[model samples]
Target: MKLSRLGPVGEEVPVVWEEDRAFDLRPLTADIDGAFLSSDPVAQVRVALADRRLPMVGEADALRVGAPIVRPSAVYCIGMNYAAHAAESGSAPPEHMVMFMKSPNTVVGPNDDVAVPRGSTKTDWEVELGIVIGARASYLESAADARLHIAGYVVANDLSERDWQIAVSGGQWSKGKSGPGFCPLGPALVTPDEIDASDLRLRSWVNGEPRQDSRTSDLIFGIEQIVWELSQYLILEPGDLILTGTPEGVALSGRFPYLTPGDIVELEIEGLGRQRQTVVAG
Candidate 1:
């Protein structure tokens, strides 16, 4: 099922979205997050759905959709995971995985407005696959074990401000990446059974023109490898978000202009869903 949350920000109600219909998730859990995911709630949702215990959400068509999952505990990101994207930014693919993080608060609804930090001159866009952790993962020994800890996938826009991420901070990336609304996620949290992550068409747009067009197949480090490697280093708790990295075609590549107020940014991944956000001044 496509698990979603809709309504005003912070007042969102959980629901199971299937095609044109939405069913309330309140009967099972108050929210879709760390607690719910860890409990293997998909089985519970399936049972409730089978028994027709889920009621149709009211006025579902007009409700604002929030990020499918609640704010995660951490937003870990891999850098240089896409070879072409790495080369475009003047770097080589790493021999060892390179990772960084954005403050969890940076996450916002997929369609929410993205605020360009004041005085920013090089804000950019990236379309990526986001992994949502389902259970505690520590010292995982293999990809098979890592796979079991994943709750689902979502489309993520790993928005960046090159000026802050590179020009200052003496090389730390989170400084430029932690602006409010930097990580726009969701539309829905698709269960692992619903989609395949190995290869999906990942795309992005600015205003109405195409910018990034690539596939998850181009990832220098695949999904299972990313999760297993991360597990060896940090304790991944339920609901932690891991952005596997983005493909080429960002303003940072210098093939296009940086985002400005009023620019519309759209990102999508096959079978997962899409995200549309407007760029606004901070």
Candidate 2:
């Protein structure tokens, strides 16, 4: 079921689908953490919402949507998983996955404006498929088993600064990618069963113009394999998000160009929904 946080005036509430309507579930489980309610809490919330017996959320009129996951333990990313993106970087496809981390502080609402860091001249955007972990997993035996731990997907823009990424600090990429507001996540976190992950079209546009365009089919290390590989090292906790990598159309790919202040970045993955944000001076 599609779950979200809504509320009245200033308080945010946990809500779930019930009988085709949204209902507040937080009141019933007052002391429980919303993120930990992934199990029957979601199911109960759905049922309670469906039934008219549940109390009406009097504050619904004032609610604002927040990032679906409040506090993910970690945000991991796969770099250059798309062959064409690797080719554009002038590097051969790696035999092993290229991994990086974006600080959790960087996560922002999908529709929020992207803050262009003061020193950034080469701000860029990457359209990617975001994997939200549903269950704890570690040392996964195989790719086939990886899907079991995934809850769903979301569209993400991995905003980057090429100079901070590659040209400085001895070429540590995360230096540039981990900046605040670097990760724009969620139109929604769609359950894996709700959409086909392997064949969707991924696209990004800057200021209403197309930039990156490619398909999941071009990914060198697809979702399942990437998850399996990641599980071998880091423990994947519930709510941890992993970016499945971007396609060949990123500004870093050198086909079109890089982003500047005042540019609006828009991205979408078929079935995952869409995200749009404006780039502004820090």
Candidate 3:
């Protein structure tokens, strides 16, 4: 099942997408957040649909699509989880997983405008698969165990400002990554049963020109390993978002010019959905 939130920012109402239509789930819950997911939202939604209890809220195209879930406890990210991306950045595959964090405030609607940091010229884009956790996970025993904790997936654009990330921030990537609106997520949140998170294709483009084209098959550390490894150190809570990293083709590889004001960035994950954001000067 595909779930979503719609309406203006901060006023979004929970919804479920089925047969190309949007049904209001507000009667079942106030918002799609950690608490809602903890209640086995998918099962609840199923029962609601079976009972014909959901109301037809509005046409999918008529309402503004907000990020599928509400503010998460944290937004965790994996660095260079794709071997090719690691190589492009002049690094070898790491013996251990590399992790980072993006300020949760960076989150925004998938189609919202992305603001270029003031005086910045090295802004870049990364298309990644985002994992939404449904249960608390800590010190998981194996990758297989990690799989059971996943609730769903979403398309994510991990926007970055290269200078702040590498050259100017004393080596912390979050400095460049935590800019407001840097994380544009979702067209919808799709349950694990609805799609294969292991081998989906993810791509990105700037100003209608392809910049990154790759698949999750190329990930050095797949979703299961990422979740399992992260669990060893931090507790993965319901509604926590984990960006699994991007593939090789990115502006940071110096193959294309970095994003500029007025540039339109598009990102898509097969089966998950697509996102389009217009870049504007801060």
TM-score of each: 0.98, 0.88, 0.98
Worst lDDT window (10 residues) for model 2?
31-40
RMSD in angstroms between candidate 1 and the native structure over all alpha carbons: 0.8
For residues 132-170, write the lDDT of model 1, one tens digit per residue.
999999999897888899999999999888989999958
Q: lDDT, candidate 2, residue 129?
A: 91
Query: CA RMSD for every model?
Result: 0.8, 3.0, 0.9
Tell me the lDDT of model 2 at 58.
56
Q: Which 10-residue window in model 1 sums to the lowest lDDT?
A: 169-178
Worst 10 residues of 3 by lDDT: 56-65
Off by over 4 Å in 1: none
Per residue, candidate 3 scores C-alpha lDDT tens digits across 11-110 of 9989998878888998799998988887888899999988999998856688888999998999999998888899999999888888999999898999
lDDT of each: 0.92, 0.77, 0.91
Alpha-carbon runs more than 4 Å astray in model 2: 6-12, 17-21, 27-42, 52-64
Winner on lDDT between 1 and 2 is: 1
Off by over 4 Å in 3: none
The clash tally of candidate 3 reads 0
